[model samples]
Target: MSVTPARTGARPARWPTGVGRLVAGAALLTAVALLPWLSGTDPALTVLRALSADQDPTPAQLAAVREQLGLDEGPFSHLVHWLGGLPRGDAGTSWVSGEPVLPQVASAFAVSLTLMLGALAVTVAVAALVSARTLYLGSRRRLHRVRAGTGAAVLAALPKFLLASLLATVCGVWLDWFPSSGWEGPQSMVLPALALGVPSGAVIGGLLDQALPAAFNEPWARTWCAYGFPSGLTARNALRRTLAGVLPQLLPTVVALVGGAVAVEKIFNIPGLGRLALDAAMAQDLPPLQTATLFLVLLGVTAGRLLQALRHALLGPALRDGALATLHQPALPRRRSPRRVAALCAAALLTLVVAGLLRDPLHVDTAARLMPPSAAHPLGTDSLGRDLLARLGHGALRTAGVALAVTAVSAAAGLLVGLTARVGAGLTEVASTLPAVLAGLLTTAVTGPSVWGAACAVCLVAWTPYAAQAAALLEEERASGHLLASVSFGAGPRYLLRHHLLPAVLPALLRNALLRLPTTVLVLASLGFLGLGEQPPTPEWGRLLSENQPYGELAPWTVLAPAGALVLLSVLAVSATPSGRSGTRRSGAAS
Candidate 1:
């Protein structure tokens, strides 16, 4: 084989350039800026509702309110007026509080920035240590590999809010090592940071584990290994390559972090942007919500671009391209039986359905209250004497229904958006920036606490990541040689999508679905925890966890049973997806 020489200075031909991303970012911001008017709630009514909740306003009162807020003007006029103020640094005023949006956001920014930075630091440190340990151990012992894998999965599987609660209960209430919830000082930031960071670190560690071996197998890396270099040095270089390889893949994780922070902030009672976003969305306060959404989009776009730039600067274009090529050309997966995995997942789903259909979760028995596990109650009875097993079944059923609905909507919407990337880029950006918690809260504000509302909210924000993933896969497939030949052969867009595109996209779609389930469950649970999901006596998994948390010590089973089930189901969902090698594959057609 002939050797190819390295180039001195050339832009990475694959993926979007900085200028393209900037244009996309601008487009995304514009789409998000119009959300206030596009949300279907009358801005005048939202303001009126905020201003006067006790009494109904007449037509004349509505008219006066409309004129006062300039809602009488057309949408274009309103849009122009709002857009015009951006150059002057005016973000408009919060309809509810009558204060300037910028000041409110600015004050809250410091707390959120601190929390995020602390969490980031914790994430990097923990990920590096765990990844290093895993790499070293995974090479030496099978048991070590198993242990490391198990630990990473378990850590990653735990929901952030649940983790937060457990940490607060253990460290704050029981051990008294720290305050349970606050934003007082740097000391108060530790628990929340850990709560957020540990799971992320675990995820990163797992990714590193997958990437390090490949990096080590490279010729140059192997030569270095043969030399006197330490394993740590090899691992460090592997990490650099691994991060470069995984940067685009981490978008979903980054989105989840920003989105989930709202719930985490709410739980820890930190007065950050997350909490502010929730509060603003709940009140349907357009000005603040718009400003928050814009800020979030800006932060996300800016951070992503900066990260890409930094990586390019550090690695140089040639090395970065090589790393990316390695990532794109994943090795074939081990020949594990897909049918076996499918059967197990199917069995678990069927059991959930049967238990839900057969059980009566609402039944009461005062005498059996707070009973420990026994033949009569496999999972024990709650403080209210309701059988925990039955409640869990019913809760699982409800959660499953929500998960199914949300997943279906998200998957469908994502597929559409993914296929039509140029048209959907604006939408993807808006949804990605708008956190799930904030979306859920906004839905609750509009629809009130109910199952449908919860589903809508989760779907509203959850679809974008799937869309982005689909779009990315679509782009890759489109670039493949066969697709161009098929196009040249006069294949219509529809035929190409159905035959060539769908097959190439299927694996990722399935993966996205499975990965999204746990996050969806957690978001619903967080809403339930906050009393904005399922309402009372609904027996949703999250509602059960929330209602029973106060009595965690009094009857640990009440809390642990549901929490355990959530974790187990999440694990099962994750396990169900195929972890086969990456890269595009033809499915439905010969192309």
Candidate 2:
């Protein structure tokens, strides 16, 4: 039997060294640092062509174009151009609108980013509130619990865009309280921020429902309670346990922030990277496309990596001891029952239904646009006369598709990278720690904001931290007695991993992914909203909300439908998760 290790305030066990790891890490980081340059290569080539052009046709012209674009310059010159300092504005003009691409994109990027970040702050704040409420309700009277539960469910069920629309109509228009759209500054951001935040709040609130229960059941909770501690005190300590679980859930939320910003910015006309990327993609401008994608990709990677760092910083010693204990502890038996399976299935199905129902179902037809909720139009029409319901569906499908894909692809990729470190390979090490800051830029370059392009970019960069985590955890496991004993019995790596390691790691993987799923959906929606994904008239959730801003007061449902779907999906995801939630007070407190 495995006995728990006596832990100290020492650094945690980490993965071993390997050259491959270094190379991979170097590749990603180097890519980040040099992405703008590498991505700018083709665009520079075009510039060179324009500069060297004498006649419509000339071999010398091609040569001059190459020379001017720095093709004639040595590798060092190319490198110099690639890393070439700050671009306050563009070196090229917009092929589509004849605008100076750089300034337009730069300003737009600022606006969009402001919207995304502002909304993120609001969402995080609201989620924190909801989580607190869930914790507060846990030990409250039955009546209060019931009320909180119903309210939580309702809040979670409404989609983000839907909530945004309602607020736009009532608070924004009817009340004449807030701006319906156009992010002129912080003041104009009020409605969109609320819309973006409501869904996040719902999701976090629901997670608290699960986490609070689990915390109250942990050994710590029991220990505290047995000591005659006040219920409030016990609950607070238990909350620490719950907070541990919450770590895994936070990563996805950051990803979702990027996506949400895309949508909110578009509606508010807030310029940000997402908006720039979107415009670049639509116009097929390769430079900005790659640059923007690289930014997002870096953001995804950096988010995961930072979260990993925090985990180690906060829980490394505890996790080490817990791992050692878990290794020796007898496997917890699974309860085999039809009821459990049925319940889980029902829960999942119900959530899926909510996501579907809340989808924007808009169809593009100017004649049918922007009608209020009425008999002639079920949910009402948009300014373009499109069926808002169909548009909502389209948005939901796109957002859901991206989230699912990003989670699956990124998680799997992370796992593959992580396992390589078990054998002490160095190559995995460097790659695992890569700080690829230019992910968004590279993504823009590669796919130019095409949905597939953005998804691929996210996958490539997003998986890095997960890989780092899995690798580090396994490294600790490899050093333990359990591994030694299994190896002594002639156990192969594959066998041990499949039978023992996978079981231990599976829960963490699932929990992390649970949070990521909704985040991915929201992120994609935001990107599309920023004009990064899908062509015009596709009516994605973010885009729909953005288009209807002018009429946010007159008929807000158009935006609400899609936004509400996003919020509901996020909430359902959080609720269904096994853990991750807010702090809660315990049963007894000093009265």
Candidate 3:
């Protein structure tokens, strides 16, 4: 009998490196410098207001400020001037404070960095514990894995802002165990770090949980197991190999943490770079915003490089030997009745919408303010005396509707680009590093905060993930034997694509889109929570949470109602994931 040798050292996805990386970084910086012009806000007017909010300066005064700030030149000139001062450690001056931008940016960056590090540590710890628990349950307890996965998905669905609100209310205000707000000491950091880290850790844990089992199922692993090797030794080797495949996901998780920190910092009142950027954007302070953007971009680049180095270190000899398994698609657990769960969640959401439509979301009763749940108010009443049930129900339609629209548009655009464009990977990599919150800041800069601005900001980067997935699928399909055979039989490019590619790629992309719905909702909510979405009198899920946060201790139901709705929506999305067979196929192709 002939034995087939194992495929060793599966190579990870490649990203821009060396000179290419430098070019990418430079291009991003240039774009950042041009943001003032892109925003279309008059810098002189903005500066005048920042300098003296009540003063209405004359054209001559505006011109003087303009000339003093070197705004007489084009946007490109700003980039050149900023670049010229970099070597000497100059980062220009802040328009709002008139202080050195570098010092302010540095101080904010340090605080944000500390928060990020703490969050990362929390992420690592959570992922490790979850993964360890799931692995301990073993394959025989498939039901346990399903429950664990559901828990993780639910946890991952919890938005940082919502979590921050809950932690502040329960742990900080009610229990008085920790400080609810401010950056006074280490205790204040706990809530924000947990809020950011727990959800992210759940995501990472899910990835690890999926990857580890897949790695163990490899032929080499089975062979070792059959040879009487200690289970622990074999498990350790499988884990090392799994890490090599899972490292790529760290980039997205890191980006999420950074993006989430915006709301987290806001909620905690921490002076992080995210809050600094947000404040600068709100005030139209270009210098500080630009500097903060620069720092964030640098941090992302640094993270990417470090992850690459770690991947290399983990793979080592296996990289050359092809012993490591390629990254696998995480399969949805099969034993559980996800369809039933999805159906229930959907019905519940629809009921909320229908019930809300019958009620008056805008009606306010000052006498009934902060009323607890009763027959009159199914959920409760907010501080404003508005019915929580009505607001949640009505807000569901707006939040879910906008999220669906954005996801559909993003998926369609991504599919088109991924199937046709060769640069999909590069674009995805670049866009993945940019948080939607930051994009919202940019959009707000131009469009002036509104629902459409938040939607537009989300659309900017949401499509990249779909595009990357489609591109990978296309590449895999092109290399398939069946595709080559069809080509040899005189199949035209149009025929090949229409008959072969679209059918094969569309379902998976759609499924991917569905899985991403919760994330979309969360991002949109994050924007609303930050006051970048719909203005007052508008009942957005995020805005509701934000507006009621102050009263969380007094009337916890006000916050819980919206938070619960979001959690249910997330569950609905996760429960709708397709079966494992498709995931297995995708993983096989990827390998």
Candidate 4:
């Protein structure tokens, strides 16, 4: 009989190698980079093709565009053309805007980057300090980890867009802390910064808490104590020792923050990268989309790699020698039915998507566009003749899908980046301090206006959490003797992850993943409502709300259906989670 690899308590691989993480990061980056070019000659070509179905264009105009983009050539030719432009820094001019693609994207980058960086700073400070304090909560490992998870929960629950919108409404419009629009000056950034920073800080705090216990319990921490070291010396010694472990998790956090940049920039009328990307998307400019998507993917991959290298270099021995030995053990007892619940959510979302897509694309039956709910159109039609029910279904599906994907990606990335950043506390503070706005601008400039393109655009900015968590967790894990055993088995970093780190963090990650959905739905819909996500007639929930607002007085159900669905899903998800897991608070920092 064939024998399976025997179960052993080991980490299976050392983190310093991080080969598995690097490969995964590479694959993700490549996919994101290829998206815009793969979709067409930029993302707009699909829309152009769709447009041709409705309206006839002059042959001369079409020919000029085709010639410029080499559309008459083979698909490979367009891809080659795209690849050819990369080294030369020439993404070409915008097809729709008639502007230089780079310039348009660059203009927007300024605003988004500033906001994101600012938020990032707040996130790191809160995570680091809060996590440090959580260490003192003392001895209760599971409770400590749960507390640490809180940072992530808060961040997940309070998405950037929601906070930005609320801040804009209150501080910008009412309190007058910042300008109402057009990012006029530094003063204008106040409300947007607050919106972005508050939630980020909470996330950081939670991650730090998770990392602290592991760090404090390290052999070195005990060593310092055993050596009769003073309290300050021991603490400093612990911080210094864990820097290597911190880098892995901090990188992803940055990427998630970029996603927030769009909303923050938009709310403040910052005209940063998010605004530019939004404008380009509304205009369907292909070149801008390509650049924006590339920039975001590139940034995320590069930052993630950098942190990986650092973690490998510093935490090399412990990960290989100690952590791996402990990861080879058999699976623990199952808690309940996480797989079932996840599947159910997935199925429900898919159903909504199918229903929405099958419904009418155009809600414009001028006679029934704004008609109140009645026998003919139960939910009434929108500005277009499209049924509100169909639109709601589609909108819910898209928003939920994008939100889920983005959240998963961001959480994964955040865990990676946060792990890395914790390695160098001072460096983490400095690196995370850059506003999400800055990263937002850079990535947005890269992707321009396309929805998929925008997702790519934000990935780099989205990776912030990675940097924040790395240092803390690694330090703590190393102290816990896990890192020591991890290496004894000679496993690679990827194997270690499959066996160890991921499982440990899974509970928290899952919670964050679920919490991110509701706000993510709001964010996606907001973008669509603002003319960014799925274009007109696509049946986006946010767009529906915006479209129905004028007629909401007549048919309130139109607004309630989409909003209600969103709320219900969020509540259902919260209920579905096992009682044992309740954000960072319930989990404790050590688990």
Tens-digit lDDT track of model 4 for 210-328: 33444455444445557766666655444444444444445545654553366566656677654555455444454575566555555555665676567655555544333222222
Model with the higher TM-score, candidate 1 or 3: 3
Q: Which model scores highest in TM-score? A: 3
Give the Cα error of residue 293 in candidate 4, in Å. 2.6
Summarize candidate 3's per-residue lDDT along 1-591 as a digit string, tens digits. 111222211112344344444555577666666666777868778778877884667988888888887887877887788778878999888766888999998988888877788898999988887678546543322333443255666777676777888898789988999999989877887888999899878766765664455445554555566777766766666666666545655665676566447777877889888788777766667678777777766776677667757765765643334332333333333545567778888898888778877889999899999999999998899988999888888888788889999999999988876655434444445566666777886778678889989999899878866775566455444543445445556777778778767865676566557656767877887777676777778888877877887787788898888877777787777567553422112222212
Which ten contiguous residues of candidate 2 have the minimum total lDDT? 582-591
lDDT of 1 by residue, 1-591 (tens): 111222221111343344444565555445444445656766667667778883566878778877877776755665566667878999888777888988898777677777777887777776676566646742332212322133454566567766788888889889988878888898899889888888777666655544444444444454565675666666555556545433444454555555458767876888888778777765666567667666777766666555546654544544333212221222332333345544665676567546645768888889998998887787788878988778777677678778878888989888887766545544565457667666665566567777788788788777766676666556545544355555556677778778767876666566546644655776787777766677777787777776777677788888887776665665565555555433243111110
Worst 10 residues of 4 by lDDT: 582-591
TM-score of each: 0.76, 0.61, 0.82, 0.57
Runs off by more than 4 Å, candidate 4: 1-60, 128-136, 139-155, 211-247, 281-284, 309-591
The per-candidate count of clashes, in order, stands at: 0, 95, 5, 168
Error of 4 at 8 (Å): 14
lDDT of candidate 2 over 1-591, digit per residue (tens)? 543333321123344443453445445544543443455554434443444432344566556545544444443553334335336433444433445545665565465456667766876676666666545644331212322233344465444554565676678678888777666667787787677666666555545444465445444445555676666775565455445434434544555545324444455455566556545544334445444544544455565556556655544454444343323322211212234433554565455445446654434567666777676555677787866655665556666666678888888887776676533234433332222222444676656767776566556556743554455445444544455456556677578788656654555555456554655554454445444455576656555655675576667676566555555554455445443212221111111
Worst 10 residues of 3 by lDDT: 2-11
Candidate 2 at 303: error in angstroms? 7.3
In terms of TM-score, how similar is model 4 to the real structure?
Answer: 0.57
